[model samples]
Target: MAHDHAHNAPPSETAMRVKALETLLTEKGLLDPAAIDALVETYETKIGPRNGAKVVARAWTDPDYKARLLEDGSAAIAELGFSGVQGEDMIVVENTDEVHNMVVCTLCSCYPWPTLGLPPIWFKSAPYRARSVIDPRGVLAEFGVELSDDVEIRVWDSNAELRYLVLPQRPAGTDELSEDELAALVTRDSMIGTALAEAPAG
Candidate 1:
């Protein structure tokens, strides 16, 4: 069954309120727009999903590192120097042929900021928070991920104390790819379990 999902849903009320407050503050000369842009850039580029991508790439190439990561997500991730704030307590979930893992914050939008950066608007929406748990498979389908009936779907609920990151399965034709090359295939949504790692280009 195909679902008509709006991937670009409008910002939630909270986001609108925050934007309004920022505008008001900017108008009052209290908040520097350049500073805000710099901060967003830092998270969006430098310290964002790239950090998680590196971690995933390391795990993909090194079995020992992958074992440690699966055993102690926080410590293993800290080795890569991505830790602080919402990412203090992390749990790495592996997605295999038999099982697919999806993460959601049922109570609030608790995310691994150091790894995933800012949460997407849909992640904080009432519909996603509620529906992700109630209908995980449907949510995956909405995200354009289709799994076979033989595959098991596991939905993880993230909270203030613990956050989950999905270590997506590596693409089949990436055997000769370097760690950096492999990292390039990892995307933010894949780590968040909303999508799969990008396949290598021809």
Candidate 2:
């Protein structure tokens, strides 16, 4: 039996170049290597969409918490111990059958990183920023989310001062799910409004 070595190949040229650039910046004291590492660790562990997922799950399970979340996203999210620069001012929009809400940063990727983790490259791409506002339905269609003709689609453009997060509708048959299990069904794209929450696995 032969093993595949494709996965063991050296880093791509672009990756190597990026690594070299980072090394140069670190050596020149232009960048704080420790800070970069800490940021990466934060995203990978402490700060991520899981925070938002937990919030969403709680809201789905507790009506009062849901009301509080919808009334004041920043404060409600703070109640969950998630607060930071990018998330100082936040708004959470709910997705309903009659109204589907989407969020985008037209100027730049002004995302709620504390709760939503890092924004994906597509979220920051010029195409997404421009199209998400111009033709939100088309953009959602591109992502394979087809809404009924009667369902109103509202596109929220985030800015430096404030950010928006989507509270996707809870999937059915998950009434018995534990908080952690419910969180596991959430995805980064779902929180970003690019996709729906994962349906419960049978």
Candidate 3:
């Protein structure tokens, strides 16, 4: 699969793309550091975790919506107005006692960044990409998540056309908790299905 074009292409071509974007942004007065920081802060606080919490809360309280989320994550998530940008084509995978799901980007890190914010540096690492598929149990062990031998592991390799998210099982003792409180219990890893949300101790 080696391509002569990649080997022969000038490195300056990649650099030029960045240079051109920087030039355009600068000329349009859109590269202000303060404005960029404000935008990042607004999204990081307002949209990303809010979406996760909403999904988790619904799954905890509504059986019908939970079924819909498990069957069609994009449509279920769209119910909360969480779509577009990186979330345009989202898929939600649910983990059960018999089957466990894990996601990785074998080709590139195609992720639901709108709902999950940015992909962590570790997610974009070559080690994670290779190990998650080849040694999923080992990777999960590193994350302190041990699976039973009876459970079958399925690794999803994300493509540009589709993205995957995990819908972790809700914790117990949260039956009376409000949606906002339930949201607080949903963690980033839980949404990825690697970890389960824990109910707060009274």
- lDDT of each prediction vs. the true structure? 0.92, 0.89, 0.79
Per-residue lDDT tens digits for candidate 3, residues 13-122, read: 78999778977997898887678678879677866755766887888788899888878888888898788777888888877778888878877887787667777777
Error of 2 at 64 (Å): 0.9
What is residue 58's positional error in candidate 3, in angstroms? 0.7
Stretches of candidate 3 off by over 4 Å are: 1-21, 28-42
lDDT by residue for model 2 over 77-167, one digit each (tens)?
A: 9999988969999899999988889899999788998898888899999999999988988999999998888988888898658888899
How far residue 18's Cα lies from its native spot in candidate 2, in Å, is 8.2
In candidate 1, stretches whose alpha carbon ends up further than 4 angstroms from where it belongs are 1-41
lDDT per residue (tens digit) for residues 119-157 in model 1: 889889999999988898899999999999899989898
Candidate RMSDs in Å, in order, are 7.3, 3.2, 9.2
lDDT of 2 at 34: 89
Ranking by TM-score: 2, 1, 3
TM-score: which is higher, 1 or 3? 1
TM-score, cand. 3 vs. native = 0.79
Best by TM-score: 2
After TM-score superposition, what is the CA distance of residue 202 in candidate 2 from its true location, in Å?
A: 1.6
